[model samples]
Target: MRYLPLTDSDRGDMLATIGVSDIDDLFVDVPAEARLSGPIEGLPTHASEMAVEKHMRRLSKKNLAAADAAFFCGAGAYRHHVPATVDHIIQRGEFLTAYTPYQPEIAQGTLQMLFEFQSQVAKLYGCAVANASMYDGSTACWEAVAMAGRVTKKKRVVLSGALHPHYAEVVKTMAKFTEDEIAGGLPSMQGSPDDAGLIERIDENTSCVVVQYPDILGRISDLTEIADAAHKKGALLIVVNTEPVALGAIKAPGEMGADIVVGEGQSIGVGLQFGGPYLGLFAVRDPKHVRQMPGRLCGETVDAEGKRGFVLTLSTREQHIRREKATSNICTNSGLCALAFSVHMTLLGEKGLRTLAAENHRLACLAADKLDAIPGVRVLNDAFFNEFTVVLERDARELVRDLAEDDILAGVSLGRLFPHEEALSGGLLVAVTETASEEDIDALCSAISENMA
Candidate 1:
């Protein structure tokens, strides 16, 4: 029997108690133009669960999933192999059912996991400390910029043209409400930010200089020069990583003296569940800037008994206590995902992770070699980790669509992300993971060759 927790009368009574005539009044703040006039046009108003499931399955069958095709798409999110054990452990009733550990006494297990996760992230990025987790890489990036502004007490932020467009936009949106200035929304470098151009843009007014590792087109740069340039101008250097796996092979941003490091941790212990429920990894050098870092941090401390224990420390600086004076308003942490990431990292260990990253790079290089052999395709970047961009002879959007028709889930077309950049509109970014087999790469290469011919 179905349980009706709230009947129509109950809803009406609640609405009346709140001085609202109907439930729709609650949504009055939403613009009338934005509101749906009726139920979705083609969908049925109601259906039995079984019927809905069948219909959904039918609809799902019309599209190709990563497993169903030679998938190469990875602009930010990646398709990686998640071990069966990760799901099994995370689904434990104790861990899955628990909420935020506001009380450290009862939340020892949860808090400990976060502490470990933070430690792992700090080590991975070669930073002093890391928070539990943020919403995703993009938001973490925004928070990093805000933190830089606070620490430097400067208004201007220099964003590399090589930064991801979506990430750059998010930072810009946040800057709008702040007193900070953002300079250089330059075009993406496809491989790395134009270091020379970024260096040129830095000035005394700049608080931080931001650049991406293996940037939008998957090009890696030794930020020592850029970091030195920013530091010379009394500006902090913020490094972004859309793909965390690259860190295994490439130099850590912190090693090059990045004041702050932020990245998407989806490649590790996270699945590309259609772009979301991903983890954000943020780390910073040990300094006063720690107070400006967003999100909650779990610290290890001894209890009255002198045994090992975990507790929430430095919370007085958060939004609830500090109000407008708080460093950030981010109240929630990506707990479960963070736990999953911790578990995955623990299982992989340092050696396993590095091997996995090497495999991904190897496979990607192989795929790039094959694709570049195609008559109309030319690999753009000479240096990349697991992803690279290819310039197509024809429109990249059309090529992607044509390849998809053959059950090949090709790379992301540059036109899809940057519509106005004529030079890049015909480029497509392709990625390869350890999950992609040699056969998959060969199939994708064959599809592109046939299409181009």
Candidate 2:
């Protein structure tokens, strides 16, 4: 009752003020079948706090955690070894409880950390400027699309077939409200990315060409050519990096001529907590486009005392600006997660990050070679960073489920990612990070062999 403070009369009054007949009228845009008519079938309608906690703990145990298995699951979110120090630093009272730095004076500490984080992201992306952070990789992706549309003044978006399906979906979902035309199809089951295909699709009306580096299937492509092609057509190149660690070993998208570089920062400091609160890294290759970028921007400044200080250099979010004029409507950022990422990045300096990247690729190659040797599996990528695709003789979705039941956390299945596409039914994506040991790889290979047998 305390939480549900609004009375029926109050709700009626509020609804009338909004000129809606009923609460249901507010969700008119949602399809009828998608709306729930009653309580969830298996979940209890209400329960005591202790009872709920106990039930949740029991349910949570059913989840095979990444650390508990010969983990290989990565399709955007990665399970990197987050140093205990990262968690320790972020858990400090000041960093953990700090909210958005609305007032720059008292929130200098928060602003400073964000400024450092932005610097790390910009350097990592090879971008001229980067925002503080965004909701996640997916939303940052959509924001990049929206920003491209604003900068290029076009409606058509050419997405790479190799772009993460989830990221593409986010762009498409947001495009519905803006009426932006999305053009792309499922990725071809090939060794390389469809660079030529994506380039061919770019036209005068194209606002941006979105491509994921070391794309969904873990195949790396040179973004320079695509960037040049998009620029020739007056379209911007928005490169999405789902795995930031790869940048340590490969070229940054911005360095490759991408106009905007955005990605998930989960691999750095943030661990895969099932799915999210992941960090979103957003940046622009040119400082001129900074105003058009979404989320907050922390800038270095000198206070009245001539002391170095960090301030909210630019806050273009809807909360800080007029709704129609704001670059994005994102209310707040993944502040804590960003801090974690920053801490992790700081711990893994330039040399350390490169070493980590190398280790990831080393393990991935080992796993790929081992898996390819299996009777019914074949590695798909000729060049991959730390993740690769394998085509199996059997449906990968079934294999994954079977392996999962045995407490072996197999990789993501293309069948699960693209449920309706039968062409991808037998493709499995296996990710290998530094956390995965030689024995873990052996265990994974052995399990797959047994299951496929």
Highest lDDT against the true fold, candidate: 2
Could you tell me which 10 consecutive residues in candidate 2 have the lowest summed lDDT?
313-322
lDDT of each: 0.86, 0.90
* Residue lDDT tens for model 1, 1-453: 134589888888999899989777889998989988777898756667788799989998876778888889988888888888888878988899998898888999899999999999999998999999999999999999988877888989889877888898899898989856777564653544578878998999999998988788777768899989999999999999988878888888999989899989988878988888999889997656777788888898998899899987799879999999998899987888898889988988999889989999999999988988888889888699999999888888888989888778788988887777788877888999998889988988887777775
The C-alpha TM-scores of every prediction are: 0.88, 0.88
**Candidate 2: tens digits of C-alpha lDDT, residues 1-453:** 445799999999999999999888998888989988777798757667788799999999987777788899889988889899999998999878777787878899898898899999999999899988998999999999999999999999999988899999998998999999999799999999878988999999999999998899999978889899999999999999999999989988888999999999888888888778888899999999988888888899998999998888666445556577787778788999999999999999999999999999999999999999999999999899999999999999999999888778899999989887989999999999998999999999999999897
| Regions of candidate 1 where Cα sits further than 4 Å from its true position | 1-59, 186-192
